[model samples]
Target chain A: MYKNILLAADGSNNALRAANEAIKIASLSNESVIDIVYVADYEKTKEDVLHASSADELMIERRKKIQNVEKALKDNNVSYKVTILHGLPGPEIIKYANERKMDIVVIGSRGLNSLQEMVIGSVSHKVMKRVYCPVLIVK
Target chain B: MQSLKQQWFGNVRGDILSGIVVALALIPEAIAFSIIAGVDPMVGLYASFCVAVIIAFVGGRPGMISAATGAMALLMVPLVRDHGVEYLLAATILTGIIQILFGIFKVAKIMKFIPNAVMIGFVNALAILIFMAQVPHFIGISNMTYVFVAITLVIVYTLPRFVKAIPAPLVALVILTAVAMFSGFELRTIGDLGNITQSLPSFLIPNVPFNFETLQIILPYSLALAIVGLLESLLTAQIVDDMTGTASNKNKEARGQGIANVVTGFFGGMAACAMIGQSVINIKSGGRGRLSSLVAGSFLMFLIIVLGDLVVKIPMSVLVGIMIMVSIGTFDWSSFKYLAKAPRTDAIVMLATVIIVVYTHDLSIGVLAGVLLSAIFFVVKISTLKVERKNSHYIVKGQLFFASTDGFIDYFKSTDINEKEITIDFSNSRIWDDSGVAALSKVKDMLRDEGIEAKVIGLDTSSQKVVQQLDGISSSH
Candidate 1:
């Protein structure tokens, strides 16, 4: 029943699982288009960016992950467009999804334990709480 | 030197005003710290003056203030009590020597390894210590002391809400001191704690006989003083750098502190270091140059010389109130809320550091414990890293560092393999150091020993370069 699907990938295995789930959902509908997004997660990577000698170096590293995600989507024959955003992952993903009016969001759970997930507040949990659309969190 | 002059002389008015404010704050604090160290109040005052003046000229951090601190005071109680002031002076000079060596060795660079949790813990511990130090004055003293302390706290906390022009603590200290003088209560004053010298401090070498026996007596205390002094000074500089959005020359600051201590010792003063409370007060009062520190020292000497009688009469409870306010202001209260939100390991580290520091009254041990625990937790976390094997190809993900080397090898050993050739992909991971390269070598040797040909692929340029360097050297064998 999903028409517009937003898949958030971080190049991790969990994210790859979510991408697969999004592919399956898109394949079920003829008019479905998957918008794949990769958030650079500034809060998590700010130190790396600051320590790196040049912005070009960081961009090149990120491009490799994006290329891998693109290859995966192409191999699955999923009609998709790719976009990269820089900011906190959860809020940025939710904002993009809301602005694009995506019908569903597929995200990966980092599989933190209950205590850790409650304390640190996993990105998926934040997205699930705030996103307007239904969230499919792949563990 | 030209740039140094500019840095020192720039914003002269702000510096002078801030210096005067800091000097005022320093008087009661210096006297109080001297009492804690079991030395005459003049010793702490002279040390405050000498350290302030010398550090102003040579310190790495221009806008920061350094003076006689509670941390250094607490460390000196035994030395002053046993060997007397003469030996304490010798220890102070030696402490300066050791700190100079630390600067020469660039030990200030080690500040990077101190994690955020440890810093928060240090601040909290210091806050608790400062508060606890005031408890003696709170109990068994005149009931008037409590009233004055409450009045001072109210003025310190509420005055800023109405007027932002003056520092609230200074206003509170001045107003409360005057009130206590007029109220004519049987209040303990700075003079009640220790004698205050009105004459200028003169330079003289410590009178202790220089011998192996003397060295043995002073060395341990001197070492403790040196390390604790530098730790407090460097951490204060870091905090000020964050406050003023400027970087400090940590090595220079270390050397400056060393020189200040040596000079203070020669002038019959106790050991001195950075005071975070006074530095915050200076910053909040518009101090922004080396001149402010210069003024703080010169003005303090002037105050003691010219206004010694008036200063001695200021109630101890007034100082107690200001310190209590400092304790309240210095504490990272948000950490309580953060404890529930932060990772359990981090919370544990912070809590453990705070507890140990409070119990042992040793800042270094607490921080060391926190750093050690953080290292252990890091090792545990990285060891959980996994490598997935699929159809003669292995995908390694997660950080590969010294902590994870053995785990990486074990993961390779446990996987069932029958293929003649295998490719290992490292597209999703980073090899952090030489240990990682060594681990890869062991993995290849293990597979070779099993008669399976193995090759690593998908390494990023940096990792590829490391592997190439190692492989080039090994293939020649």
Candidate 2:
């Protein structure tokens, strides 16, 4: 059941907890492997783009962030690889899971509050509402 | 603007399909409603001409068709009944003038008062009323043969989709009228009632029995017109939205309604509103932009002018068939069925409106009753706010939600005492119900007048111990 688990990482602590739990369960099964991924919201605009640093610097920082997670996985003696892509965060994450034939996808529910989720319409809510695959939204 | 220009014209196939359907649809509805308004069927056509034309050009929603509707027709009855057709025509003209004034004053924002439930109630009730009204036309067997009209209704309803481009009403009218005409069926036809004028509607003055008395009498009628007009147009605009995948500013459309009414009145026609049945037919038939509506109005006018005599020859059964179709189209069966299964309050309100409409022969009466009942329901729910009384202390909980706050204050004033010494422990409460706060403030003022110590103990104090402290007064959790 734990084999080929897709860990939806948002560089959040609780997502890390779920990721750690998935890795541990996978290592214990000895047949499971972890696929780490981050989904960027592609609909973000130029004004939004201005708020962030240049692409190369952002990629470098993302790499460092993954390394931190990788170190945590290593400390627990778990095995994994990472991928980063851009699109509507929830759908993209689920699409990646489906495309890669991963068993399950794990995500963090920290980005949006319920009211904002209702209005701006959260990716996780959309995923929960639309996606056929099983998704765990860690609080 | 670019998209508007690109899609504004063309779409001939959709337009023609919708146009023919609307034309067939409008003939019966326009005539029936006109009859209901105590006028010749052609006057209904004249109204269809004026409103459909003006609104087509000026309307915010491109595909929405404005024409005489049963709702407006029903409203016109009393006005026409008491004042006679001439005065009714004057009032109709004035109604349009008032609508135009509404537009010029930019009063479309006022339409927001009509809520979703009420709107749903309106359309659903209207659908029921339409079907009920058509009962006599379908049943060919006279002595109250709206039932045979029902059979013609059934055939028209069931056969239309399978037989494309052939409007159902026309089919029903032709087949049924032929049967009635040739078979010498003891059924009444439009010609039997009175001779429809072969002459086109003569331009008349806006001389609706004008006076303060007339205005006072017709105020509610006009208000009903305004409400029904606003609701139908707004809803039709929504349909147009779904068709074109575009959004319309409803308030703007309402302003357009006001302007259209004013113009229609200026032309000495009856009150007109957005015809949802025709509008839907128009859109689904491929009408886009204002062209279809304009074409429809122009065509209707052309028919009334050139083919008035032939139109008068169309049997009442055929017109009934057309109305039966319109009734089915406007009938919100799904919503009606859903409402039937809804809560007792909802069901009661809907049924009450329906009953009032049937009994009073007034749409406004039904709607007013429905609205009032809805208001009463809100007040009852508001008044039910939990008030825990413990000796000299009181704890108010739940939202002192708006529309309910005044009742809460009144309850305390009537039942409780000690204006100076009373404590309202709201510490356990999570929200300061806006209405509740206003009510509490009012209570505080009243207490001040009586020289009572009115103290608010737990308003917005998020301390968990406040709950325990309040419990000490009642000695219960």
**TM-score of candidate 2 relative to the true fold:** 0.63
Model 2: residues >4 Å from true position, as ranges?
A1-139, B1-7, B10-13, B104-107, B131-151, B178-186, B194-202, B207-220, B266-268, B335-337, B340-344, B387-396, B400-477
User: Model 1 over residues B88-128: C-alpha lDDT tens digits?
Assistant: 99999999999999999999888667666777787788779
Residues B1-477, model 2: lDDT tens digits: 225554456665676567667776677678887765777675677788888877766777887899999878877777777766665565665566566666667676654444334555566567666666656555545543464466676877678547857667767766776666566656666665544554434555665455788677666667778766776676666555544545666656777777777666656578888977777667656677677787788777776666656565556655665665666556555555546676677667766777777777766667677878877886676456667888778887655656557656776778747444888777545433444445666777777677776677765653333333443443111
lDDT of 1: 0.82
CA lDDT of each candidate?
0.82, 0.66
* Clash pairs, model 1 backbone: none
Candidate 2, A3-120: lDDT as tens digits: 7777766666766776766666677677777778865443331112222233345456656656656667778767788887655577677677777777766666665345746656
Q: Superposing all C-alpha atoms, what RMSD in Å does each candidate have to the true structure?
A: 12.4, 13.9
For candidate 1, the iRMS in Å is 10.9
Name the docking class for model 1.
incorrect
